[model samples]
Structure formats: structure tokens, C-alpha cells
Target: MLIGEVARRSGVSARMLRHYDSLGLVRPTGRTEAGYREYSREDIRRIFHIESLRSLGLSLREVGQALDNPEFAPSELVDDLVERTRERIAGETELLARLRRIGAVGPADWEDVLRIVALLQALGSESVGQRQRAALSSVEDVPVPVEALVEAALNETDPNVAGALRWALARTGDGGLALLAEGLGSPAAEVRKRAVESIARIPNGAATALLQESLTDPDVPVRRSAALALGARGVADAVPTLVEMVVEGTNDVDAADALTVLARDSALAEQIATRLVACLADGTMESSARRRLTQALAEIPGNTASHALADLSHDDDRAVALTATYIAKLRNAQ
Candidate 1:
């Protein structure tokens, strides 16, 4: 076949075929009387081979090597191609995400788009100061999208930067709560903890509702964080988890303090006292856990708490009895 026929049939353009010939990648096997280049069957087959290799991301030189070198192993080259393809895909995905985030900002013009992009880049900056500054300024001037704020907050490792991000997110209102809620379901324990932590800072009913749902999270830390936040909000739903925290000795002091806050209501005081008394009476509770529970009961002001403390004062464990005696005396003194 002549060059044009070969180009038409193989889908390789004539210019590219000439370039391949110049590079000695695929030379014509013969020539006609007019001295035009003619491709034999083997030459056409080589052209197709070059195109096939190029399709797999091979450079022209690499394609030539692959077609001509008898010792050229494809395994390493194929693996390298796979890695390159993966990297390209990852880069494209990141670009798409950045574009989506810029679009989400609802930029009014090119300047607005650039500003949002700059703010986002700063949020992801390696410098802690830059990240914190971006987070603080996100709610001012041009507002950073809540999605960006939430992403920063969930992945932020520095305490100050994370706090700034959370503050920004809270100011953004419940708009970021949906994304943060998805973070709550992340398989990663750290991500779930971050999600709940960010949610806890959001003082909206929606955030509180999500926290209430997170009370049953499989991760104990997430459950504790959610319980603490809910307890501060005066939600009685956190009562049981608070009681468990007291028994487990995990943040038991803070848990006890939260319970004290919840106990301000007369009805809730009685309910809180009742749960503490029940935990105290459970046989499975070790002596140390019982002691923490006794100390926790000291904060609850009600007949239920006082009576439970009085009963525990005569318990089998001397340490428990002494702690209970001290608490009961304090209650009596009050």
C-alpha cells in the first residue's frame, strides 16, 4: 500500500507515518517507478504495532525499542505504564475535585474564582500559620465554601488549625454538617473521631441531632465525644453514655461534670441519680469503677442520690464504703 492508503486504512495520519519513517521506526519496504514510498504487508504490520504500543502510553522511542529489541521485556514497562496511568488518573481526579469546589463557591467572576482558589490552596498549605489564617479569613471577605472548611477540619491535625477550621465551619452554620456526617461514617477511626469532634463544635439542632445518632458509634472515643457535647447542650439523651463513661473511667471526671450540668433540672437530677445508683449496684462493676460511680453521685442533688450514697456507705468494699461515707457526710453538711 502507498502512504495515503496505509494512512486511511490504519488510521495513522500520513504526517505521523512520515515522521515514523524519518525516525526509522517504520520505513517503507519498497518504492514505485515515480519514486513514491510504498509500504509492504510487513511494513503496514509494523505501523499497526507502533500505534498499538502508543495507545498504551509508550513514547515513540519506547515503541521503537519494543518493536525492534528482541530482549526488551514488557513486564517492567507494562508495570511502569500502569503506575503512570494511575498517577494521571489521580491528578485528574484531584483537578476535578478542585473544580467542583470552586464551582461550589458560586463565584461571581474570574476574580472571585481566583480568590476562592487561593483561599483553598492556603487552607491546604503546609504552614500551620497559613492554614489557620486561611481558616480564620474564610468566613470574611470572600467566604470559603463550607465544603472546603469541613474538609480542612476533618483532615487538620494541628490543634490550633483544626480549632480555627471548626470555628469557621460552625460560623458557616449547618451547611457543612452533611459532609461532616459522612465523615462520621468513615471506616477510619481517626476520621470518625474528627468528624464527631467537628460536629460537636457546631451548636445547631442538626449537629446535635447527628451527635445524638453518633452516641451509638462503634468507636468508643467517638461515642464519648458525642456524649460530652450532647451533655453540655442539656440533652438528657446522653445520660446513659455519660453513666458508662463514669463506670469505664474514661474521661470519667469530665463525664461526671457533664452529668452535674444535666442534673440542674429537678427531674433530670432524679433520673441521673437513678442511673448512677443502678450502675453502682451492678455486680459486674469492679470496685474501682464503683468508687468512681460513688464520687460521681456526690454531684447529684436529690433524694435518690443521697439514699444511694447512704446505702453504699455500708458496702462490702471498705474503700467504697469510706468514699461513700465521705460523700454522704458532705451531702449532709450541705
Candidate 2:
């Protein structure tokens, strides 16, 4: 097998494979005539074993020892590995228990619960305990446990835990969306902003309806959150709101972004693109809107993208001319 193939099959990167080779763990048996590394069947077999051991959480040194001593007993290493595994499990179990105590799995609870569980597991209780005490020792700050992070996330009140939950959400993969949904009804605007940011982190399924609601929000932060979440989700529903926001608003980066996302459609992306192109092409828009107009047009697809730029090919605006040129180049490349 080729080195790339070996790396793919083993689920190890080429760089890591080379590192393992330097450590004498697994190496190519020979080189091709052109000096490409070649692997024998035996080398492939060893790689598979090494990968398995690594997945089992064995250290590289331990894996090397096991590889060198074919008769080495994994049983001897089982106890330490088991303890490490238990510590991991304990974090997940603790988080799950906390979630069960949360506001009873509301509209925002999705598969991301697993991510929060894993984050708690990865952060471990002991480190958090130390941090909590240190936080308390320095000032009169009430000691907030990690459980409070979830509790605050579940409640629309308690901005402290809500803020901390934002940090927690940042640590986890994309689980913060659920928390964002949970906070949509929060009485506080700051909470709403952080909630929007959390929702922005994942940008899919859960944020859609809420974002639709946010487009009509009384609060600017909430409205911005709605736009950002809609754009991040890349949903067609955001197109109208984005278009309106793009033409009417100032410093509405999130709104413009949402519109641009819609315009990039191969199939459904066109739902957003055509609206933007129409607005710019007819001169219904002012020069102030030209920058965002060009941006949205550029994100659009081939013949459609070219046609959008063609409207501005003879523009009196220098920025519009430059941006249109960029769009023409991109369309030709495609």
C-alpha cells in the first residue's frame, strides 16, 4: 500500500505516520522507484494493531512496548486504563445527571446534550473543584460549581451562570445551540446576546425557528442574533429577512452575512442570490448599499453570479467596479 493509503487505512495522519516511523513503531518496508514509501502486508498489519492500541488510549511508549514484545500482556495495563476510563465515564454521568435536573428537556434540547456530557467528562471534576475554590479564595465571590453552568443554561434568569455556560458551550463541540434556544425568552438583553452567540456557534436545525422569531425582535441584539443564527444555519428562510436587513440597516454585519449565505446556493442557495441581484441590478438601491450588494452577488453561483456582476460592469462606483471584476474572475474560474 502507498503511504497515503496506509495513513488513511490506519486513521493516522501522514505526519503522525512519519513520526511513528521515526520512533520505530511502524515504517514502510521499502520505497518505490520514484522514492514513494511502500508498505508490505506485514507493515499494514502492524499499523492496524498500533492504531487499535492508540484508540484504546495507550500511550505511544506503551504501544511501542506492546509492538516490540509480541507476548506483552495488555492485562497488566488494564487497571490504569480502567481507572482513566472510569474518570471519563464519571464526567459524562455527572453531566447527564445534571441535565436530568435541568428544566426538563425543553425546545432546545437536541443531540448536543452528548457534547456537553463529553465536555464535562473531558474537563473532569477535580480540576473544576480546584478552580472553584481558587475563585472563592480570592474574593467574596460565591463559589459556583460546574453544575451551575447547566442550571443557568436551563433557566432564562441568572446571567452569571448564563455567562459561564457560554464559556462551557465554547468548550463543547456545538452543544451551545440548545442552550441558546433555552435562553431565547430571557428577560435580559445581555443574556440574549450571549445566547445568540451560542446559537451562532452551531448554526443549524435548532436555531431556525428561533431566528425567524428573532427577525421581528424588539431588541437590536436579539434581532442581530436572529440574523446571525439564520445566516449560520444557511437556511432559505433567512433570505428575505437578510435582504431587508441588508438594504435598510447600518453596521448590520450579521444581517448581511445571513444574506450572503443564502446567495451561495447551488440549489436552494439561489433563493437568496436572485433577490440580492435584483435589488442591485435595478438601481433601486443607493451607493451606500453597493459594497454589500457586490459581496452578495459574488457569493452567488456561475452564470447567475456572472449576470449579477454584469449589472455593475459599467458602474460609476470604483468599489463596485473592483468588486464586479472579482466576481467576473470567480465566475470564469468556475
Candidate 3:
């Protein structure tokens, strides 16, 4: 086959075939009487081989070595190609994500696009200050997309930066709630915790509803955080988890405080008092747990709490009796 026929059949351009010949990668096996280059069947086969190797990301020199060197091992080269392909894929994926985020912002002009890009870059910056500034500026001027804010919030390790991200997310309204809710089910414990923390800061009924649903999360930290946030919002459903917090001695103080807030309602006060009294009566209740529950009951104004404290004031454990006695005295003084 001649060069044009070779280019037409093999899909390798004539110019590239000539370049290959110049580089001695593939030379014509013969020439016609007019001195035009002529490729034999074996030469065409070598052209296909070069094209095949090039498709696998091999450079021309590498392709030549692969075709000519008898001792050249492909294992190491193949592994290197795999790694390089993975890196390229990762780079492309990141760029695609950046482009999607920019598009989500609905930029009005090139300036808006540039600002959004700069803000996004800053959000992922190595400097904590830049990240924080980006978070703070997200709600001002051209707003950063809530998706970016949520991503930052979930992965952020710095406390101040996380707080800013959550603040920025909250300002975006309830749009990020669904995304944050998905974070609640993440396999990672830290991510779940961050999700709950971010949701708690978002002051909306949707966020509160998500927190209510999170009350039964298998992760104790998630349940505890949700309970506290719900309790502050006066959701009575959080009472049980708050009670558990007091018993487990985890955030027992805040849990007790939340219970106190809930107890301001007359009906909830009686209900809360009854639960506390029952926890006190459980024989398996540890001494420390009993003491925390006793202190928690002190805030309840109903007769149930007073009667429970009065009974506890003379309990067998000296510490329990003393703490209960002090609390009873304070209740009487009120």
C-alpha cells in the first residue's frame, strides 16, 4: 500500500506516517519505479502496532522501544500507565466538580464567575485564615453555592473554620438541609457528627425536623447532639435522650440544663419528674448516675420531684443522701 492508501485504511494520517518514517519508527519496505514510498504488509502491521501502543498513552519513543526492544518489560510500564491514567482521571473529576459548582452559582458575568472561582479556591486553601474568610464572605456579594459550603463543613477540621462554614450554610436557607441529612447516614463517625453539628446551627423547621429524625441515630454522639438541639427548641421528644445523657454522664450538665428548660411547662415537668424518679429507683443505677439524676430532679418544681428528692435525702449512699438533702433544702427555700 502507498502512503495515501495506508492513511485511508489505518486512520493514521500521511503526515504522521512520514514523521514515523523520519524517526525510523516505521520505514517503507520498498519504493516504486517513480521513487514513491511503498509499504509492505509487515510494515502496515508495524503501523497498527505503533497506533495501538500510542492509544495506551505511550510516547513515540516508548512505542518504538516497545516494538523493537526484545528485553523491554511491559509490567512496570503498564503499572506506570495505570497510575498516570488514575491521576488524570482524578484531575478531570476535580475540574468537573469545580465547573459544576460554578454553574450552580448562576454567575451573571465573567466577574461573577471569577469571584466564585476565587472563593471556591479559598475555601479549600491550606491557610486557615483564607478558608475562614471565604466562608464568611460566602453569604456576601455573590453567594457561594450551598453545596460547596456543606462540603467544606463536612470535611473541615478547624473549629473556627467549621463554625464559619456552618454559619454560611445556615444563611443559604434550607437548601443544604437535604445534603446535610445525607451526611447523617455516612459510614464515617466524624462526618456524621459534623453533619449533626451543622444541622443544629441551621435555624429552620426543616433543619429541626431532620434533627428530630436524627434522635434515634445509632451513633451516640449524633443522638446526643440532636437531643440537645431539639431540647433547646422545646421539642418534648428529646426528653428521653436527655434523660439518657444524664444517666450515661455524657454532657450530663447540658442535658440536665435542657431538662430544666423543658420542665418549665407544667405537663412536661410532671412527666420529666416521673422519669427522673424512676431512674432513681432503679437498683442498678450507679452512684454517680444517681447523683446526677438527683441534681437534675432538683430543677423540677412539681410534687413528684420534691417527693423523690425527700425520699432520696435519706438513701443508703451517703453522697446521694447528702446531694439530695442539699437539693431538697434549696427547693424548700424556693
RMSD of each: 2.5, 24.0, 2.2
Better of 2 and 3 by TM-score: 3
lDDT of 1 by residue, 1-334 (tens): 8999999999999999999999999899999999999999999988888888999999999998898899999999999999999999999998898899888878889999888889989998999999999999945687688878888888889999988888888888788889999998889878888899899888888999999999999988988999999999999999999999999999999999999999999899999999898888899889999999999999899999999988999999999999999999988997
Q: Residues 1-334, candidate 3, lDDT per residue (tens digit)? A: 8999999999999999999999999999999999989999999999999999999999999999998999999998999999999999999999998999899989989999999999999999999999999999936696688888999999999999999999898888888999999998899978988999999988889889999988888888989999999888889999999999999999999999999999999999999999999998899989999999999998888999999999998999999999999999998997
Full candidate order by TM-score, most accurate first: 3, 1, 2
Off by over 4 Å in 2: 1-147, 150-164, 170-182, 202-204, 248-264, 281-284
Question: Which candidate has the top score in lDDT?
Answer: 3
List runs of model 3 lying over 4 Å from the truth.
72-76
Tens-digit lDDT track of model 2 for 153-194? 444343443445555544444544655666667787766666
lDDT of every predicted structure (CA atoms): 0.91, 0.65, 0.93
Better of 2 and 3 by lDDT: 3
What TM-score does each of the candidates earn? 0.89, 0.46, 0.91
- lDDT for 247 in candidate 3 is 97
